[model samples]
Target: MTEPMTDLPCTARVPADVEAPDRILWGLTARQIAILAAAAAIAYLLWRAIGDRVPLAVTAAVLVPVAGAAAVLALGRRDGLPLDAWLLAAVRYRRRPRLAVPTEPVEPSGWGPVSERRPLPAVLRLPATAIDDDGSIAVPDTGSVALVVATTVNVDLRTGPEQAAIVGAYGRWLNSLTGPVQVVVSTQRVDLSSQATRIADAAHELPHPALADAALDYAAFLDELAEHRDPLGRTVTVACVAPAGARGEAVRRAEHTAASLTAVGCRSAVLDAATATAVVTAAVDPFAPTDASWPRTPPNDPVTAARSS
Candidate 1:
């Protein structure tokens, strides 16, 4: 019923210049342009070394640049953080050398902290061993369920004492967890599409003429807000992972997590496959919303629907 009066939000609060990707030189990022220059220099050196050997020099010119680029990219991709990121990770690893050691019971497990210098996949490795109808991501490899999505707590508007109590409660829950649990917070554009749909839904259900008219006005305000800018939203995910093999164990953990969050003044629940997919999809590409991937809306009160579902 509150949908029609919803406010649109602006996400990606980084300044325009900071957010804008650097163009190294003439439409090239620093990484790309720098690499190209290095490759050219290496090719020139190879050609000079093979001078007077006509065919050999020409071959060296082509192969040297190709080999240099291929080697760097292969190294970067294999390490999971290409070029710049990999270099940064390498420095951090150097500062703490112990991270280079392989994890115990490793190889096929696909569990535990990612080692310092290993080739990591571009996408996070989900060790997803199975899928539950209720939408839990299961991993039989470690008898764990992964990627369990949960909502965030908004404590900024609360009084200091309330915020402190909520934080303490959440801390206790973390201390109580028996196994590995990963929580991820990503900065994503506000889901204005969903917000707008909700407002429309609430407006339709209103029978009071004055209220409906006011709802319509608010909806128009949202439309105008969207055209200009929307405020940023805070999205939080509490993923329960590395629990026991039993399916019930996963649910138990999730329930505990949800209850703890509720006590801390946050509305929380375990997500099914459909919602989980949307969250992951948005993480990868926030701009693309597929018809099949996004749920169709008829403007229902999300809070009521969440409770009923």
Candidate 2:
């Protein structure tokens, strides 16, 4: 016995003659085989039902097993796997390692007890841009002002020659003004639904049905009257007077600008009606005239005490 060769169980090797089976009956994954089987069954059932004129019961019998297998496969494939799980896994797999080292923890100084450091409140940390209501970019304070409002005008439609004269006057006024002006036009639809509802309400409150109907009819007539009467068309022209300073020169410049605007068909007046009235009154007061020749006082003192008297 050549030193009696005893093979250790752990060290024993598989025999070369022993081989794994080349064909496995259940080698296909649960999903793959089920899908293939389902497709074949569906094809067979369709052919039998349509081509062979089989009854629905027989067709269903063939299809039910295929459908069941397909459902089971689909359910198994989806089981416990959320839509974002794969995406999250991929992101984690591809993430780069951070390069920085964490700071070492240190004991607090003996000034006071160590307090927990909490992060700032989210509201306080929000950017100023996020605080704006209109979501517009912040503008620097440039010290500019603007006033906007609607305007009304009474048109004089007397004669063609009158219109021509007015036009000529307007042209002169434009020649006189020194600054730019803006004109705005807008239209709005009047809502009659509220009126209709009111009429209906009144009709309902009438003592008799006939009276109620009559009242509703009257309301309808009123609504029609409002709708048909002079469909309101609006045009707004602004005579913007921007004076650099509130001093006498600014006032004179403003007046000159206004006169020029008036010559062009544009009516220019000081925004403050009272101030314009006072100036005009002072200029025209005959009793308070400083000189007999001119119907005006010094531009600086338009409203002198004598003129006021």
Candidate 3:
């Protein structure tokens, strides 16, 4: 066997033992390889076209690889390519022309110096709930004390004396109070639907059929009027009486003022139904000189009675 060593095949004699190359001279991705081939063909065509005027060999060698690399770079940028391998390869190729090692050096610490000592920005604290809608701030409740609804009055339109008396009573009522009071005047639209319905029922029961149509027409008219008219039309003037002291003291003072007005022969009540005149008389001695005298003439006009000392 030793004497016939030259007769053996290369693989059989060497036992097929060999280390594979880490990188190939023409190492490239499928796309990169295509781009490089195209660039080489273009360079060859250009050289053939202008070979007589220029050095074709030198020009092809210099420009073909550069054009291929440029095309590859442009394609990589457009398509999100892995740049780490390419970059390492380039760096290795630059460092060692014939051979290259792709291993990166380990830093002394876990991370780089700049990354280890980077400063962080300060954080700001804010309240958990908002102030506007949350209603964290306290607010005072401000509303009217009570509403004084006026009573209805009817005067005899035919009798002049009765009308005058009613007018005089109203004048007295107006002058009796010394505070703000709201006067609400409301005018409501009339609805005749129930009346029309009653009429329709009556017509239906009757022998004649014409009345039923008339009743229905009347009902329709009434409904139309209601829809067009302002049902809740009103003119309300609100009067707010704010007392000077505490609630209890204010009520007492108001009662006293009402009594004083009644002493002048004006019809008034401290709190409804109870007469102020009796209240005033019972509160003070009848023989006391300080007590106000009863008016000789009828205190029908509150303004005149109020003007009297």
Q: Which ten residues in a row have the lowest lDDT in candidate 3?
A: 129-138
Scored by lDDT, the top model is 1
Candidate 3 per-residue lDDT, tens place, 36-76, comes to: 57777876777766776768677767676768675756346
lDDT of 1 by residue, 198-277 (tens): 67779878889789888778877766776788545556777776555566676667778888878777778776666665
Tens digits of per-residue lDDT, candidate 2, 260-298, equal 545445554532333332233433452342211113332
**Model 2 residue 153 distance off true place after TM-score fit, in angstroms:** 8.2
- List lDDT for all candidates, in order: 0.62, 0.45, 0.42
Model 2 segments more than 4 A misplaced:
1-160, 191-232, 239-309
Rank by lDDT, highest first. Answer: 1, 2, 3
- Candidate 3 C-alpha error for residue 274, in Å: 26
* CA-RMSD of model 3: 45.2
Candidate 3 stretches greater than 4 Å from native: 1-145, 150-158, 186-224, 228-232, 235-240, 244-309
Q: Considering only N, C-alpha and C atoms within 3 Å, which residue pairs clash in candidate 3?
A: 181-239, 182-238, 182-239
Sorting all predicted structures by TM-score, with the top scorer first, yields 1, 2, 3
What value of lDDT does candidate 1 attain over all alpha carbons? 0.62
How does model 3 score by TM-score?
0.22
Ten-residue stretch with the least lDDT total in model 1: 295-304
